[model samples]
Target: MTSFTRPFILAAALATLPLTALADPSVAPAKDSLEIDEPGGVPAGYVLKWSDEFDKPGLPDPKLWAYDTKANKHGWANEERQYYSLARRENSRVEDGQLIIEARKEDLKNKPDWGGQHYTSARLLSKNSYQYGYIEVRAQLPCGLGVWPAIWQLPTTDHMMWPDDGEIDIMEYVGWDQDTIYHTVHTGLYNHVKHTQKGVLKHMPAVCGQWHTYSLTWTPDEIREGIDGRDYFRFVNEHTGKGAWPFDRPNHLILNLAVGGTFGGKTGVDDSTMPWQFRIDYVRVYQKPE
Candidate 1:
């Protein structure tokens, strides 16, 4: 389920540090020449339409990102335990040329909708949206039980609720299942709750410690997902109607690190693994040449 919700009742806390403290001066700037090991270069006809190399350090480019600060005591749907922070750098930051989203064990007892959750993290959404394109995210995942990190997409408009509008999960990892990564798609007619969602799991032993390119190529007829340029899953439109294919409209990107939730906490959380991090080196979107 989507982690978007409204604030609940809780007292406001005192002000915290400014955003400047989020930058890490010790980490040298990333070299612009750093290269990823994608299987091949851009496909023959696609053109780069947008990209965020995260070359700059600080809060994420304001022009490109917006925070998902909705707080719910019950984890927004999957029984998550993080209070998505919009004012704290302890949860989200840009450093050493990468976007770092961290989940820490700490309770903001006074914050609105504070439900005594002992963790805090960040969720970011791309301001821009597109109908169909080749989307790629280069990242090093976080590990340890209870950590659920994801790179996914959702419809840009609220014309319909989740599942009805569509959801594309390029990559989803649960620390307990440290060796497997999931690629899934949810629609009204096909969803996990109904036991009919379209998905696949790929085994990659070193996923947490190394950087990998997770990608999704969406077109009018189908959606394909992969890692390091090798596609492992494909879902095609069945022409059965919108219930099964709600991807025709523009969809925006979401990057988040959730803690101790339905899937991630199935094996139960190792609170000792309190603080975890998810890092993204770059995100790029390309469109087919007309």
Candidate 2:
């Protein structure tokens, strides 16, 4: 249900922070030096592969990112109400060294693909794809009911339908469930509709009010998801068949902030919470040297 169908497909520094630090939403957190394997805490053998520090203040680097608005005319998956805008600075921008993906309560009535939606947002896809690596993102989440923020990955092959090529949810946080964070993996044999998706929910009381690191260390044998250097979820290749593990193919990254969907708006959207934001400090990927 969290699928970004027709999608293309498509950091982090602080190992941990004190509980007191999580209370302030305005106080910025320390920036990670991202030296060597410190970004995702991968093994020393891994080398820096790619990264976007969001240093330039404007749209995301065109060389490394592209927009995904293929399903804007129609509604997005999970019954999301937001229209993913294309190259719109109002929805996606870089400022003060961070990538800000904002979900605003506005209607793009003039756009050809408007579709009568009241909210506009952005969904960014990585221009490059990878088979295996340690990927990391440090971000601060937005709040208020109806906000659904995510950092995930999907296969690059347009031929492979979802749940067949595999999906890796590095992090998912719905504003309605403001205190918990989810990490999951889906495949033909294990998905949400079937009530068999493999996932883990962790209590992150200040997730929406402070900065946190979310990451995926993907290898040939398994995929591990972690936060602030602590692993919480992992999926090991069962070697049974593609139904259970279809992750060998190249996959790209996705970063989006959806609104009023089945998961985020199940309880109903809070209009007062308009203009929610998902702030990304940095994104880094690392892989072993060839």
Candidate 3:
């Protein structure tokens, strides 16, 4: 039952935001940028709220992870190719002080198989939800022409339904864009439609298969996305209005690795590709005094 729906084209105006392209030679496909960028960390005053150090090695931490077996096809933005299964080892597991979401290159001839995608991986979601604050997750990405890994959060409001329920894709990458990373937000305004807005940051640094701490700081005033402490993009909630600021509720976390789909086609995926994996050192969250 897990399937992918058509991608909603984001509005050209939102794509035009200054971060549309990252031009740093270190992270960008080619070096090009004028502003001098500096490094930053968890904003001052924020304290460690919650964390999963991955101390054990057999099945994921029950306190933090749960199987997402929803049968309805996920919009699966960007041509990502992945099918999430409930009890399959190929899809997820905890190992060696870390979490692994394995992506296999083969034919999936079973349940929830979209039919076309031959790769299987895990998309684990946190049953726990945090209302608002700074969230930090440290993990190394799996890099290959077709590998896609992400550490993001979503609203707990299944009651409101999707889109309106909202989603925050803090860190998402397709194997092809090895060095560069993408941070996105999907609300009612930009939920899988041609009229959505998105901001992309490029030319940061290498994050594939290496440890890097990714963070998201959400406040009533703004939403900021950072990599290893350095901020790449900020969305001003006040300037964007309520439609773009539906992040006012508790949002859960998700860690997943996907293969070629929408953005996957650009990089191309060969079923002969053997196996790929997504590694997570641990996940931690923080909340400031309310």
Alpha-carbon lDDT, every model:
0.73, 0.76, 0.62
Candidate 3, residue 189: lDDT: 62
* Model 3 accuracy (lDDT, Cα): 0.62
**Candidate 1 ranges with C-alpha deviation above 4 Å:** 1-41
- Best-to-worst lDDT order: 2, 1, 3
**Model 3 misplacement above 4 A:** 1-39, 72-80, 107-117, 160-162, 190-192, 239-241
Better of 2 and 3 by TM-score: 2
Worst 10 residues of 3 by lDDT: 17-26
Best by lDDT: 2
Q: Say which prediction, candidate 2 or candidate 3, comes out ahead on lDDT.
A: 2
- Using all chains and alpha carbons, the TM-scores for the candidates as numbered come to 0.84, 0.86, 0.78
- Which ten contiguous residues of candidate 2 have the minimum total lDDT? 12-21
lDDT of 3 by residue, 20-114 (tens): 11111112311121122346567777777667888887778766677654421442434445666666766677777877888886556656535
Displacement of residue 44 (Cα, Å) in model 3 is 2.7
Q: Superposing all C-alpha atoms, what RMSD in Å does each candidate have to the true structure?
A: 10.6, 10.2, 8.3
lDDT of 2 at 26: 18
The deviation in Å at residue 60 for candidate 2 is: 0.9
* lDDT digits (tens) for residues 43-140 of candidate 1: 66888877899988778887788876644443444667778887467888888999999999888888876767888888887877777888999999
The TM-score obtained by model 2 is: 0.86
